[model samples]
Target: MALAVCVLFDARTERRIRELWARLESRGVHTLATHTHGRHHPHLSYAVLREWDLEAVHQAVDRLPDGGPFTLTCQGTLAFPRGRAALAPSLTAELARRQESVVAAVRATGADLHRNYAEGAWVPHVSLATRAPGALLPVVVAAVADVLPMPLVVNRAALVDSGTGETVVLPRIP
Candidate 1:
């Protein structure tokens, strides 16, 4: 439904998150692993754009300085309206700056930024369950708690289309 500039986790980190997803899925909780499209990657987004020019947005982001890879510690789970649940990561100054830079670059391309991703409103998180009902909160919480304070290794970046699950891999983490 939107295009997101996201930082993807390394294989190790991805596997760990996937394991949690599997556990939740087995318990009848709908996680990203089997969410709509069923082709989601384990990632944390810098920004989600309601509209954008793919190539222009890509070029703009590519022009920015590389922030390189970094690690994020997810200490707890965050539940949002409409049954969305995610791992809330501790924000580092570098991560904030990188996100700001990406937002600016994409906005420069005339992309409409999703309000949730606006500068002052952003909340950095790696999504887990896409539609976890209130009845499944305990399951989601317990699954996440089992992996609390997880060290997430971010090694790549990309522009992913939420509707089609298509990705345009970025040259660097910006």
Candidate 2:
């Protein structure tokens, strides 16, 4: 499996992600998460783990000079050629620095870095879909149509560890 160091946004921010999904889905953009299969949560991540150094990441995060909350905007929908599908935009400077600090921490552990998703191609977003939701595409489109340009306030960030590879909440940082 791949190891990734990711930051889970606080709940208030998560709600905006869901709202965007709903708005986009309502507008005919097929979503990644549907009622039956998609369980991936709404959050921004630094990188998808090719190799993860949990301890190092935690340490790096601890060392990162605190970057307070910053607002990020979601413009539209996009599909990653790498098999992900969702809505997101470039992260704010604060978010990017925080993400980089985590990466730096992971690198300190001597684990091979797989990918740096925080770079230019990294679009900070709340993913609404990934893996085919099959026949529910149309339904998804109808659910999120109106809220395309929702401005979400990111109040906090967290280092979420995999809980048996299931979505789990961990301690958050300000």
Candidate 3:
């Protein structure tokens, strides 16, 4: 149905993101132990496609020219497309370069990618939460506020399915 491409953080790095999320959870500000098939995880989303062929998406990302090796600093929070809660980061050239490449490469698959993200919606974030419980957004934001300006490194990106458990690692072009 739909597919999303994201940057998978290293185990150690992801742990920190999880730790921050856990802190938010403790404050009763974010969802934990998700019931949905898609369990929550920390990630920087690159793009989403309307019509996705997982294999093609992988190939597209795989072929993307690498220009990463950047750090994104989270400055605030944002809600989008739906109830998705996200941490907004100050844009970095490398992040934008890699993101743009993924969008363009995926479009070559002939899928109509969301223009909002392709043109201007790329926020360059390390997800704080997604599909948030309407009640917890404010708390989550406040919890994260104490830790605002968390910086995440972007070294590699991947092609993944949001619903099904699937991921394809694309080598960084650096």
Whose TM-score is greatest here? 1
Using lDDT as the measure, which candidate wins?
Answer: 1
Q: Which stretches of candidate 1 lie over 4 Å from their true place?
A: none
TM-score of every candidate relative to the true structure: 0.98, 0.67, 0.82
Using TM-score, rank the candidates from best to worst: 1, 3, 2
lDDT, candidate 2, 2-22, per-residue tens: 454555555776776766566
Residue-wise C-alpha lDDT for candidate 1, range 38-80, written one tens digit per residue: 8999999999999899989999999999888999999999999
lDDT of 2: 0.56
Better structure of 2 and 3 per TM-score: 3
Clashes of 1: 1
Q: What's model 3's lDDT at 144?
A: 69
Looking at model 1, report the run of 10 residues with the lowest lDDT sum. 140-149
State the lDDT of candidate 3 residue by residue for 52-153, as single tens digits.
777777776777667666667788887765556767888777667767877888888887786666857666666666556778778777876887777777
User: Candidate 1, after superposition: displacement of residue 136 in Å?
Assistant: 1.1
Clashing pairs in 1: 1-163
